[model samples]
Target: MREVFPDAGFREPVEAAEIVEAERRLGQALPTDLRQLLLESNGVLGRTRVATVWAVDQIVEQNLRFWSDENFAQLYMPFDALMFFGDNGGGDQFAFVQKPQRPDVFVWEHESDSRR
Candidate 1:
């Protein structure tokens, strides 16, 4: 992260320590790729809502939607806002997730960035 994006913001380890512990309690692993991408590229990568590497998936059951933005957990907002979009199974791309509370966007089953 520090090496890739010099301007990327950094949360003191002490500040993020609790968040890390919480992830452990939930029995979930923060998406490593997504985290790395954000740390490497702290700023928004590409066009807005044009599909960089991910998308806000609401087509499925609302509860079933795996990716979301926790800050806007109110049920109507974008999740992949902070990360870069890659590729997805349905001809879409993937995105990196910053926090655990929000649903992170990623390439679906066999989707690839090239498809986009």
Candidate 2:
């Protein structure tokens, strides 16, 4: 994170209890690197003050909506396999593949509803 944003902003570190609950609610363990990052900072702010990474609570809320919201299903492909964590500040969002459980991250462009 620091490498990407030297002047990045960070919130207070997340507690272990919080991470445990978040994982439970999400029905899956968080990505290892993301979990570690959350332990160091609940969230990260980047250029133009965009939320480069969301807080744990936000992660839960946003994912819940993406994964189960019927409206989203009608508009786009299933989100059950992606764990979103951030955005590019222009509607494009970032996520990790959850079904296959890969270490690499992916970006979902809102306009095209594409992930790559």
Candidate 3:
């Protein structure tokens, strides 16, 4: 992360217990890299002018919000299968599609509700 965002500022690291709690709330284990990152710093900020990596709580909140939206609910069904991690200033988000053994990351476009 630092290599990609040299000027980034981060929130204080969250406790391992907190991460574990987040995982329990989300009903899935976070990817190892992401878990480690959260342990290092709950989130990244002031990286570039366009984005912020969300903290564990924010991730859960956003996912819950999206999962409950009438329009997005069906699209994001099986909610626990997706993990949102960041947002672009423009409203788009970044996330990972959880798989049995690993997660595949993608950029989720807000306007189209599509992932790529």
Candidate 4:
């Protein structure tokens, strides 16, 4: 993180207990790397002070809303396969593919509801 944005901002690490509760409530384990990152720093702020990696609470809330909210469901394709963790400081969000749990990350564009 420091290497990428020498001045990037970071928050205090979160407890393992929080991670455990997050997984339990979300019904899935977070990606191992992401889990470790959150334990080291709850979130990372990159260019323009945007959340390059969101806080654990934000991750849970966003994912839950994307997966279960009626409005999102009606507007976009099912989001259960993705585990969102960041954004581009714009409307584009970053996520991990969770259905088969691949190592590659994907970008979800809010405007078009497209993933790439």
Candidate 5:
């Protein structure tokens, strides 16, 4: 990940407790690798040339905002099933599907209102 985003800047490391609390509040467990990344650095700053990974708090805030939007919520029902982690410099977002088995990562584009 670092090699792909050499210019990425990171926030101070976050506590495991914080990550756990975030998961609890969201009513879902985050992916293991993402949880580990948050413990290392809250999130990445600067441009990754892909997306800027949002800090834990930002993650919650953004998710809440999206979940509250009628249009978005309706379009993406069961929004809780997806955990948003980052965003393209534009309005697109990145997330992981919370399934029992492998959690596949996907990109949600605001322009298209579609996930890929």
Candidate 6:
């Protein structure tokens, strides 16, 4: 993960480890760049078309842009996060999604989808 984000600095290395461990616990392997981008940053960045899962008040908000159309939304059991499942082309393109569902979850609407 460090190799993936050489310049993304964090206040503490332990926090980065925590993020990696959290990903492992969730059973969701994030794209290296995106994961590194998120993990390395203190919070969401601004003005990018790419969707993000913002950390807000004990919950996370997600916005998805650019995912395989074949992949349908499904509940990622136990983790309480939505996931897209499909077998098709792979690209740097990703459908940004968030985790830890709640009424206050991050998003303009309760849910949304878009292509990057």
**Predicted candidate 5 versus true structure: per-residue lDDT over 13-104, tens digit per residue:** 99988988888877777888789889898888766444378889988788777767787667655566678899878888888877543568
Q: 40-98 in candidate 1: lDDT tens per residue?
A: 43223232323232321221212123344363355433543333344323444354444
Model 4 lDDT on a 0 to 1 scale: 0.94
TM-scores vs. true structure, each candidate: 0.27, 0.96, 0.82, 0.95, 0.83, 0.33
Clash pairs detected, candidate 2: none
lDDT ranking of the models: 4, 2, 5, 3, 1, 6
- For residues 1-116, could you state the per-residue lDDT of candidate 2 as single tens digits? 67867989999999999999999999999999999999999989987889889999999999999999999999999999999999878988899999999998999988889999
Displacement of the residue 42 alpha carbon in candidate 4, Å: 0.2
On lDDT, the leading prediction is 4
All candidates' lDDT scores? 0.37, 0.93, 0.77, 0.94, 0.78, 0.33
- Model 4 shows how many backbone clashes? 0
**Clash pairs detected, candidate 4:** none
The TM-score ranking, best first, is: 2, 4, 5, 3, 6, 1
lDDT of 3 at 42: 87
Q: In model 6, where do residues sit more than 4 Å from their true spots? A: 1-14, 45-53, 56-116
Model 6 agreement with the true structure over 13-100: per-residue lDDT tens digits: 2266655664564456544544454555533322342223232211112213212222333521122243322111222112334454
lDDT of 4 by residue, 42-84 (tens): 9999868999899999999999988989998899999999999
Instruction: Quickly count the clashes in candidate 3.
Output: 0
For candidate 3, list the clashing residue pairs, or say none.
Answer: none
Q: Which digits, one per residue and each the tens of the lDDT, describe model 3 over residues 1-116?
A: 67887988887999999988988887778878789889998888864644377889998788777656776765554444567888877788888777545567778777676778
Model 2 residue 52 CA deviation in Å = 0.8
